[model samples]
Target: MYFCLFPTWHSKVFRNDVIFIYDKYFFNLWFDLYLKYFFLTSELIILISSLWV
Candidate 1:
């Protein structure tokens, strides 16, 4: 999902910034959480749509 990926890309682009460096671990953790959430949501949607049909 664009929402999930955008923040990671933004953080990578700003990696040299002082604030970004300080929160690098947080970003990594967030990125993982977003990826998991995205996949889970997508799968749930598919499951629900299949059941609907």
Candidate 2:
């Protein structure tokens, strides 16, 4: 048999928890992507600038 400790509030609590977890994961993923692109762009600019000088 299955049992729910908080039958009435369990669904809402579970949904909120899932959303919170997903938001954290997504935030980290996007932040890493942004940093990766920023570094790449900076490297390209430095290389181009050096070529001119």
Candidate 3:
């Protein structure tokens, strides 16, 4: 089951405690994807900026 890793950021009244149990799998998956394309995106930005300059 998926739940918000950070509960405090959301409204307390809508928290729904039963589903808020901590799990790291989703975070790990997301982070892996972020890291996978992080450099590609950064490089693309740099390349675009250099062309504009």
Name the top TM-score candidate.
2
Q: In candidate 2, which residue ranges exceed 4 Å CA deviation? A: 1-15
- Pick by TM-score: 1 or 3, better one: 1
C-alpha lDDT (0 to 100) for residue 25 of candidate 3: 46
Query: Using alpha carbons, what is the TM-score of model 2?
Result: 0.69
Best by lDDT: 1
Question: What's the C-alpha lDDT at position 3 in model 3?
Answer: 40
Ranking by lDDT: 1, 2, 3
Instruction: Tell me which residue pairs clash in candidate 1.
Output: none
lDDT of 2: 0.66
Worst 10 residues of 1 by lDDT: 2-11
Kindly report which residue pairs in candidate 3 clash with one another.
none
> In candidate 3, where is summed lDDT lowest over 10 consecutive residues?
1-10
Q: Compute the lDDT of residue 5 as modeled in candidate 1.
A: 45
- Which residue ranges in model 1 land beyond 4 Å of their true spot? 1-22
Q: Report the lDDT tens digits of candidate 1 across residue range 23-48.
A: 66666788788899999999999999
Please write out the lDDT profile of model 2 over residues 1-53, one tens digit for every residue. Answer: 11122233433456777765665666667678889999999999999999999
